[model samples]
Target: MGDKPIKQYRKSRPRAEELYSRALESLAGGVGHDLRRGHPLPLYISRAAGSRKWDEDGREYIDYGMGNAALLLGHAPPEVCRAMGDALELGFHFGNDHPMQLEWAELIQKLVPCAERMRFVNSGSEGSMLALRVARAFTGKTRVLRFEGHFSGWHDGVGKGAMIPFDKPVSAGIPPAVLDTIEVIPADLDSVAEVLEKDRDIAAVMLEPSGASWGTGPLTVAFNEGLRDLTRNHGVLLVYDEVITGFRYAPGGYQEYAGITPDLSFHGKIVAGGMPGGVLAGRADIMEVFDYTGDAHRDRYERVHHLGTFNANPVSTAAGIATLKRVATGLPHERANRLARQLRQGMDSILREEGVAGYAYGDVSIFHVYLEAFPGSGASDRERLVTRDVNVLKGIPAPVVSAFQKMLLARGIDLVSYTGGVTSSAHTDEDIALTLDAFGDVIRALVRERVIATLK
Candidate 1:
C-alpha cells in the first residue's frame, strides 16, 4: 500500500477525474445525489452485470451497492430484461390503463399482508407523501409522529428529524407549517404512548421498520409489536416505510417476517424491480380515499388527488411482475442471506485479528461494519448487535469513513455506503472471500497510517 493512499487513489482513476471535471461544468455539485459526492472524485461506472461492475477507467469491482439495495436478483437479471423488452415492443407508456398493471398489483397484494388496496407512484418519496395525505384525510387528523432518524423520503413531510437537531429541517425550502404537523420522538413505546395520550390529532405513526438508515438505529421485534398495539389503541394509523426492506427481507418483507402488519405501508426499490416506481398500500378503508364516486361533488371533495406521468408504466410493471415471480419462490432470499452471513463472520474475524475496535452485524441479507475508538465491555455481541443509540453507531468521523471507502474502491469492492450494503442472490462465496481480503488490507493500512486507532 502507498504511504499516502488518497494520492494513490487520485492517480489511479484518471478517467473518472476527467469526467468529473467535465461534470462540474453542467451537473449540480458535480454529482446527482448528495451521498454520491466523494472526496477527490466519485467513481463513474460504464456497465454492470450480475454481482459486478466496471468503472469508466475499466476497473472491475465486486459490487455490494446492488443499485442502492434495489437489485435483489442483481443487475439486469435476464428475466427482468426480457420482460422489459417484451413490454417495450407492446408500448412504453399509455395514457390509459393496461392488464400488466393489474397483474403487477396482484403480485404485490399476494405477497404483502398490508396491501389490501394500493396506488402506484414514481418513487418512494411520492409514496410517503401520499401515505401522509391518505392518513390525514381518513382520520380527520393533521399531525404525524415519526421516530428519530427514521427516513421516509426527501419530501417536506419527512424532511425534518432525519438528522441531528431533530427539530430542524434537513433542507431549507420546507415551510414551517409542514414541520409543525410532524412530531419526532425516540423509538420507545412509552414515549409513543405519552404522545398518543396527549395528542389526539396525530393521524399516523410512520417509520422504517428495519430502523433508521436501514438498521443503523435498529428496532427490536418487541418494539415493533408494541408499536403496532399502541397505534391501534390510540386510533392512529401505523405505517411502514419498506423501501429498503421490501422483497429483500423475505417474500413478503419485514411485516411478514415479523408477522406484525401495519395499517399502511410504502414500498420502493425492489417493489418495482429496480425500476422507477413505488407503491402506497394499506387497509381497504384507508385506500378508499383514492376512489372515485359517481357524484362529481363527492368525488371532488372526498377523494385524494393522485396523478403521475409514470406511475405504472408498462415497462416498470413488466419488470415488477417478472421480479416478483422469482422472489415468490423464496430461493433468492436464502442465497443472499447465506452469503451475507459469510461476509459478516469473515469481517468480524478480520477485525479481531487486526486488533481493530469494531464489529460486523446486521439482519437478514444486510450487513454493517462499525468502527469505534473505544471498546468498553459489559454486553455480549448479540445484545449490542443492533443498537438504539444513534451516536454510537453513527459517530465515525467523516474523513476516516471517506478514506476507508476510497481504499475499498482501490481494492475493487464497492459498498453502498461507507459502512456496508446488502447482498444479492447473484453474490457468490468467491465474492465474499475477495471482499474480506480487501477489507482486511484496508483496515491494516488505515491503522498503519493512524487513520483509525487500534485497540489499546
Candidate 2:
C-alpha cells in the first residue's frame, strides 16, 4: 500500500548481481533458466526458512513461489534436514545401490499405486526424458504428444513450447528435427483424439494432470478418464507428468484425484524435499525395459545405459524419504488448501465489492487471478478470456503490472511476477490475511490509477 512506485530494484545484492554479470560472460542470459529473470533484476536470496526467504540485501518476504512449486513442505523442514544430515555423515554418493534409494522408491510405490517400479534421476527433465525413452523403447513408436501450454521439462525432446510465443518454441538452438518428434495438441479431447488418429507413430501422451502451465487450470475429471481409456485402447503409453502436482495436490497426486492411472509417471518437486531428485515410475512390465539383468543383458548392462552419476544420490534420497513420511502424516495439504481457498475467496469478494472486471479460480493449494476485460462466471466463459486482450493485467504500455509487483515485493509478499501465486504448507492464517490485505490494496490502487475500471 505504499503510494510510491518502485522504479528500480537495487543491484546492491552484489553477490547475486555480480555472479549474474560474470555468468553472462560464459552463460546464456546471465542465468541458468530464462524464467529466473524478472523485473528489477531477480533478488539474490541469502537464506530461506519455512515460508520466508531473506535476500542478500536482508529483505525478508513471505515466499508463495516456493521455488517454482518445488517446496511443498516449505524450505528445509527439520525432519528432511535431519535425514539429509544423517545421510551425509555416511557419505554423499556410492558406486552402486544404497538403502536410501530403495527406501524412497518403496515409499513412492506404496503411496502411488500406479508406480509398480520406480527409478530415481537427478531432475524432472531427466526423469521425463528417460520416461519418453522407455515409452518409445517399449512401444516401438517415435512420436510423443503433449498439450500446448504445459511444460514437461528442459530436455530437448520435451522442452518445446515451454514459454514459447503463443506456446511456440522459446529457445533458439533446438533443431527443427528434434522439435518435430513432439506433437503439440490442444487440451480438448477431440483434438487429442484427432492427432492420435492422424499420427499413428505416437508412443505416449504426456500431460500434467492439472494444466499447470497456465497456473493450476484444473482439467475435468472426465477428460482425464477419457484420455486414459483412449491411450489404453490405442496402445499408447499414458504418462502423467506429476513433477509439480505429485505431492502438492495429494499424497497420491492428480492421478488419485482424477481416479485415473497412467502407464508411466514422472515426479520431482516435493519428492526431492527441496534438494534435487526426480523419479519415473510405472507398470513393472513396461518398466522392465530399464532392467539389465536378463540373459541378453549380461554384457549389455554396461552398453544399454540409462544412468546418471548423481541419480538417487544418498542425500537427496534421504531427504525425499523423510519428507514423504512427514507429509503422509501431517496437515500440510489441508493447511495449504485452506489458505488457497481463503485467498481466492478474499480476492473474489474484493473484485465484486470494487466492481472490478475480473475473477479468480483454481484448485486446493494453487490458484490464478486473471484481470480480464470482463468477468468469467465459469469454465465456459473462461475459454473467451484471451491473454492478448488482458493488457491491464499485463500492463504492457507502461510498468503498471511490473510496478504493482514491485509494490507487493516492497510490502514483503513474494509472488511469481509472471504468473499467479502458490500457497505452501508453511503459510499461516496471519500470512493468508496479510496477502489478502495486500491484494486488496493493490486492486484499489489500480482502480485509482484508472488501470482497471469499476465493473458497473
lDDT score of residue 400 within candidate 1? 71
Candidate 2 lowest-lDDT run of ten? 388-397
- The lDDT for every candidate, in the order shown, is 0.88, 0.76
> After superposition, which runs of candidate 1 have C-alpha atoms over 4 Å from their true positions?
1-8, 374-386
Task: Report residue 100 deviation for candidate 2 (angstroms).
Answer: 1.1
Q: How accurate is candidate 1 locally (lDDT)?
A: 0.88
Q: How far is 234's C-alpha from truth in model 2 (Å)?
A: 0.9
* Tens digit per residue, CA lDDT, model 2, 1-456: 232322334344556666667776987776667667755466678899898999877788888889888887887788889999999999988857887788888889877868999888888888899899888888888999987666788778875754434246657687888888888766778988888888899999998887746343446678888899889888899999998888777888887767789999999888988789899999999988766665765537422258789989899888899889966764788888999899889988887777666667778688676663222223334334434222223333234445556667777887754537788888888988888888889888877776654544
Candidate with best TM-score: 1
